[model samples]
Each structure stands twice: as structure tokens, then as C-alpha cells.
Target: MIAYSVTVPKEYGYVILAATSTFFLNFWHGTRVGLFRRAAEIPYPHPYATAEQISSASPDKKQAMYLFNCAQRAHGNYLENHPSMVIAMLVSGLQYPRTAAVLGAAWAVFRIIYAVGYTRADKQEGKGRLAGSGFWLAQLAAFGLAGWVGVQMIMGQA
Candidate 1:
């Protein structure tokens, strides 16, 4: 049998913590969204029912659908960005531990803000949504910076 090994820098400890924490938070949000769907009797396999079905349903069902949509969107957004963020954190932490940790932590916080804002808003666009969007941009910037630093280190330019 062939074996493969990988080495991670000691400084990556903090980065691991930050990445795991963010993952857990995203997982928590997804779990809550599942519960919301269950409570609404929206079925297990498809949490997002069609708009036509929601519009034709009873008032209570409609409200439940709305909440589910909001929660699902939050969960979906997290899932969409999580993998890239994790990769960036890991790579960057090898050379820039502090920055990676900070950015990861900030991303987690902003994700929560995004979920809360989307859940509470009657309309899709609101203060919380805007705030979350702003924070998300910052998180992306951090990731970009970290990636640049990691590249520089790899090239012996750092």
C-alpha cells in the first residue's frame, strides 16, 4: 500500500480553531433551518417548496414558507462560500496565522448577522442584509490578502 503524509505548520492551530468554529456556526444555522421546515410540514426531501404552492396555501402555511425560504437562503449562502473560505484560511495560516484567524472569526460573525437580518426582514433588502453584505466584502478582502501573502511566501518574496 502507498501512504501519503501532509505537514501543517504549528501556527495553523489558531486557523484550525477559527475555521472549525465557523463551520459549526454554519452547521447550526442549517440545522435550525431544517427544524423550521419540519415544523412547517414542508416535507423532508425538499425544504423549498414551489412559489405557486406557497401562494395558494393557507395563511399559516404561507408564513411558514416565507420563514423557511429566509432560513434556507442563509444556509445556502453559507454553504456556497464555506469551502473557498476554508481553503484560503488553511493556506494563508501557514504564512499569516494572525490574519487568517481574524478573517475566519470575522466571517463567522458576519454570517450570523446575515442570517438574523434575512430571517427578521419582511422584505429581502434591509439594514441587517446590507450590514451583512458589507461584512462579507470585508471577509472576502481578508481572504484575498491572505492568499496574496501565501503566494508571496511560496515564491520566497515575503
Candidate 2:
């Protein structure tokens, strides 16, 4: 077998944290889906359904399920986007631990909160939207941090 280097750059620790956080978030969301499925057997209003229809649409299991699935998808997005940033940093040779840590922490917390808010199933719709938006914003921050790292690395100041 050909020798392969399995070493990850030091900066990759934060990337690992981000990835692990995504997994936890997904796990929580999956639990939400399980709860929703159980409740769904009795019929519930779908979150995506019309407001008026929600009252008559079986009590909203579908919507609850949607939040769980969507949160998982959001984590998938984080996983996808984070690696490119890590690779870019590695290639450019720029590693900023402080920046990465901040971004990763924010993203992780936002994602966790968003998942919980979504799964709660009793929060006001407005609150859920706000929480979810915060999660997205955190993701955007991670992207920005990664881009900055990549840029600094490319500039040879990394």
C-alpha cells in the first residue's frame, strides 16, 4: 500500500470542533424528529402548511419534523463549508487559532440554540424564526473567519 499522510494541520482542531458540534446538533434534531413522529401518529398541523390549515391539518407534526430535518441540513452545510475553509487555510499556510475559535464557538452555540428552539414545538413562531436567523448569522461568521484566514495565508503573512 502507498504511504499516505493522515496528519491534519493544527488549525484543524477547530474544524474538528465545528464538525463534532454539527454531529451533536444533528443528534438533538434527530431526537426531535423521533418525538414528532410519535406525535404525528395522532395527526398534527404541518409547520409549512397555511396558518388556517394548521388548525385543521392534524396538529403540526410535519412542521415539527421539518425543523428537525432542516436543522440537520444546516449542520450538513456547516460541515461542507468548513472543510473548504480549512483546506484553503492549509494551502495558503495561514492559521489563526483565536479567530477560528471565536467563529467555531459562536456557530456551535447558535446551531444548538436553533435546534432546541425548533424542537421545543411550543415556542412562538416569531421566536423560532429569530433563533434560526441567529444560527444562520453565526454560520456566516464562520465563513467570514475562514475567508480571512485564507486571505492572510495567501498573502504570505499567515
Candidate 3:
């Protein structure tokens, strides 16, 4: 077995903060979603408001649930992509901490935009495409950087 070591860059503090802030923001968003869930009267066990739940609700209830589902989805979307994005940021950070930090910050900002846009949209049409426009780009950048870093490491040029 071979053991490998990586030196933490001096600029790594920025990367640490960026990554930690993502978790902080995600947790905060979940707290807000919990409150929203209560306001919308969405009960436990149901991950989302089903079509039947929405259709059977009164107009006001329907609106509340729709909006709550939007919030939930926004949070859920963040969770879905979280593992890979964070992992890539950390992995790439080994060689390019500053770039990783910038990418991480961009991701955090875009995710916020996506969440807010999703929560405010009246309907599900396009799924907040406008708000999330920058999200995928940032995510891809982090992923790409991680792949490049791995390649360079393997080539013994990192």
C-alpha cells in the first residue's frame, strides 16, 4: 500500500470558509423551509405536496402548499447536487485553493438565487430557470477543476 499526503495551501482558509458557508446556508434554508411547511400546513412523512393534495385544497391552501413545495424543492435541489459539488471543491482545492474558493462562493450564490426564484414563482413552469441560470455553470467549473487536478496529480505535475 502507498500513502499519499497533500499540503494545505495558505489560501485554504478561503476555501474552508466557502465550503463551510455552503453548509451554513443550506442548513439555514432548511430551517426556513420548516417554518414554511408549518405555515402551509404540510404534515410530516410526505416529502412533497402531491397533485391530489394541491387539488383538494382551498384556494388559499393551494397557494400556500404550492409555495411551500417550491421552497422544499429548492432545498431539495441543493441537497441533490451537494455531495459532488462540495467534494469537487475540496479535491480541486488541494492544488488551486483560491480558484476553488471562488467557484464555491459562486455556487453558494447561485443556489441562493435558485432557491429564492423557485420559492417566489407562481407556478412550476420552467422550474426557475432564470434564477438558476448560473448554477450549472459554476457546478461544472468545480467538477472540471477537480478532474483536471486529478489528472495532473496522476501525471506527477501537480
Candidate 4:
């Protein structure tokens, strides 16, 4: 029989905290979509209102639909990039724990900015682009860090 002990570094705890932020953000976004769905009077299994439906909707209904679509898109966009960023953050933590944690936290903040901006009444695109750029930069840094760590491990240098 063989026994092994694994001890995670204390710094990785910060990474875990950062990872938690993303889940909270996801929950918030999903909740907004649900709330908007209710406001729009949209039933389940109906992803979005049809063009004809929107055309015939009252002003308030139209606004609700607009908001609902915005919420849905925000959640969808977050889903698109979240998995890769999380993986990179964890992998980068192997070699650069503090840096990975910083990037992960910053990524969550950027996502917050993007989500809020995207759900706004005016100029969602500008805000999304700005904050989204920060997240993109964070993602690129995490990916580069992870790649370096992977290569170092392969070369037996890490």
C-alpha cells in the first residue's frame, strides 16, 4: 500500500476566491434574465420574442423584451468565455499564483462592467467594448502564463 499527501499552496486560496466571484457573477446574470423574462411576460421555452410579436407589442412590453434580450445576451456572452478563462486561471496559478489570482479577480470585475453596461438603456456597445477589452487582456495574460507553465513543466524546468 502506498499513501500520498497533497498540500495546496496558500496562495491558491486566493485563486479559489477569485473563481468564486465568477460563479456569483453568473448567478446574478441568470437572475436578471429570469426577472426580465417575468417582466416581459415571456413563458418558459420561449427564448426570445418573434419579430412579429415585438412589432405588435405595447411600449412597455417592447421595453421588457428589449431588456430581456439584453439580459439573455449578457448571460450567453459570459458563458462563451468563462470556461476557458477559468481553466487558464487555474493552470496559470501553478506557476504564478498571485498573478493568476489578480487576473482572475480583475476578469470578474471586467465582466461585471460588461454585464451592467450591456443591460443599460443607452450605448451598451461602448461600455461592453471597453470593459470587455479589459477581460480580453486578462484572458490573454492568463493564457500566456498558463502556456509558459505548461512548457516549463514539459521541459522539467518548473
Candidate 5:
């Protein structure tokens, strides 16, 4: 038998937690979109098809179309925002781990709220949408703070 020990910097603890949570949230949204697509009998490639096509396929069924739209938007929003979140979290973690973690967690929570609101209303522009925007702004702030800290560190001021 062999034993090994591993260590992580304290600052990174929250960062890891935040990142993991965000990843799971993204996965959940993706899976939800998949379920919607399956329920609608929309083919794989078709799910990724044009909006016109998707709407046309489910014409005369407002609720079904709304469900599909919600799922597609959820997945699309995740894909669009996740990359920036990853980069911001990584950079911020190196310097402002706690801030990064808090913002990252907030982002995930806001995204869920946004999804629920969008699904229920079948439209954007609401409290959930506002929260999502706010969270994204918070993330950008975290990234900016991290950049500032990095610069300060390089200048021997941090």
C-alpha cells in the first residue's frame, strides 16, 4: 500500500468550490435543454437548427414552443457566458480568490433564477434577467480587481 498527501493553497479553496458549482450549474442547464428537446421530439441537429425552423416545427402549440425556446435559451446563454466566467474565475482566483468565489457562486444562482423566470414567462426582461445581468457585472468587477491586484503585485505594491 502507498499513501500520498496533497495540499492546496487556502486562497484556492473557495475558488475551487465556486468553479465546481458553476460547472454543475452549466451542466444542469444543458441537461434540462436536452430533456426539453427530447420531449419535443426535436432531433439533435435540429435542436441546433435555426430559430425559424424550431418554431415552425412546433407551430400551433404555444406552450410547446415556449418550452423549446426556454431550453434553447438556457443552453445558449450558458455557452455564451461560461467561457468568460471560467477565464475571470481563473484569473481572479490567483489573486482575489474569495471575491472570485462569491461572484462565481452568485453568477450560478442568478443564472438559475434567470432560467426559471424565462421558462415560466417565455420572455426576457424581468427580475431574473436583471439579476443575471447584475451577476455578470459582478464577475467583470472581480476580473478587473484581479487584474489590478496582479499589476500591483508585479509593481511590488500588493
Candidate 6:
């Protein structure tokens, strides 16, 4: 029997670290989406929920819930797409493990806070957009780091 040897690039370790961060962030986002969905399925605040809670809810809550669902879907897209992105960087010989890990962790943290602020906010006072922006910034940072690493690899600086 011949055993196949999988060759991991020098950047493979960094990519794996980044993948860890992505996993955490996705889990956080998935939880929020699940909570929102569960809330929606309930009888408008359900049994234990207060009337104030129900009354204060904006009609846009539905939209917010939908957005959470979208985020969950987006998470899947990232899972599928991010590996290729990382692979591209790796192929370019660019790998920054610390940057990838940190960005991933930051993104995960931001998304959790964002989801809380987004879903629990009063309808008249929506904070989902702000939360969305924070997550966007985190994502941008991750991509930027990836780009920097790629450039270094291409320039033979990696």
C-alpha cells in the first residue's frame, strides 16, 4: 500500500489559523440567526416575553431577522469562498499566521456584539446597520492582511 504524502506550504499553518477564526465568527453569526429565527417563530414574544418587548419591536424586526438569516447564508458563502482566497495567497507564497488569526478573532467578536445590538434594538432605533458596518470593517481588515501577505509572496519577500 502506498501512502500519499500531503505537502503543506509554509503558509498552510497561517491559513489554518485563519480558518479557526473564521469558524468562530461563523458560529457566532449562526447562533444569532438561529435566535432570531426562533424568536420569529414564536407567537410574537411568545409566552414568557413581556408586552413592552413586543410593543417596542419595530416592524423592521422582521427585516432584521431576515438579515440575520442572510448573515448565516453569507457565512456559508465565506466558508466556501475563503478557502480559495487563502489558497490563492498560499500559492503566492504569502502567509501571515498572526494577522489571519487576529483578524479572524476580531471579526468573530465584532459580529457577536453586532448581532446583539442589531437584534435587541428597538424598531424605532435600529442599530443593525451600525453592527453591519463594524463587521464590514473587520472583514476589510482580514482581506487587507491577506492582500499584504500575497504581495509580499509575489515580491519574493515572504
**Could you give candidate 1's per-residue lDDT for residues 1-158 as a string of tens digits?**
43424356677899999989986897799788987787567876885867887889898787777778888878888888888888888777776778788888888888888888877746543345555775577567667877697577657666
Pick by TM-score: 3 or 6, better one: 3
Which candidate number maximizes TM-score? 3
List model 2 lDDT by residue over 13-101, tens digit each: 66556556655765765565556555543334433334443455544555644444444444454456545544433333235554555
Identify the runs in model 2 with alpha carbons over 4 angstroms from their true place.
Answer: 1-12, 42-94, 120-122
Question: After best superposition, candidate 5 residue 137: deviation in angstroms?
Answer: 2.1
Q: Write the per-residue lDDT of candidate 3 for residues 11-43, one digit (tens) a residue.
A: 988888889999898897899798779878989
Off by over 4 Å in 3: 1-4, 121-126
Q: Rate the local accuracy (lDDT) of all candidates.
A: 0.77, 0.53, 0.85, 0.82, 0.70, 0.54
Write model 4 residue lDDT over 1-158, tens digit each, in one string.
43434346779988888888899999998888899899988888998766777789998898778777877887898999999999998888867889999999999988888777776766543344355568889989999999998787777667
**Which stretch of 10 consecutive residues in model 4 shows the poorest summed lDDT?**
123-132
What candidate 1 gets wrong by more than 4 Å, as runs, is: 1-10, 121-128
2 or 6, greater by TM-score: 2
Candidate 4 residue spans exceeding 4 A from truth: 1-7, 124-130
Best by lDDT: 3
Question: In order, how many clashes per candidate?
Answer: 0, 8, 0, 0, 0, 0
Put the candidates in lDDT order, highest first: 3, 4, 1, 5, 6, 2
TM-score, model 4 to reference: 0.88
Candidate 2, residue 136: CA error in Å? 3.1
lDDT tens digits by residue: candidate 6, 1-158 = 43434345565566566656656666766666566657544353332334454456676665544444444444554466555444533343235555555555565566566555555445334445365446556566666776776576557566
Ranking by TM-score: 3, 4, 1, 5, 2, 6
lDDT for model 1 comes to 0.77
Off by over 4 Å in 6: 1-18, 42-94, 123-125, 128-132
Give candidates' CA RMSD values in order.
Answer: 4.3, 6.5, 1.9, 3.4, 6.3, 8.1
Residue 63, model 2: Cα distance from true site in angstroms:
9.2
Which has the higher lDDT value, candidate number 1 or candidate number 6?
A: 1
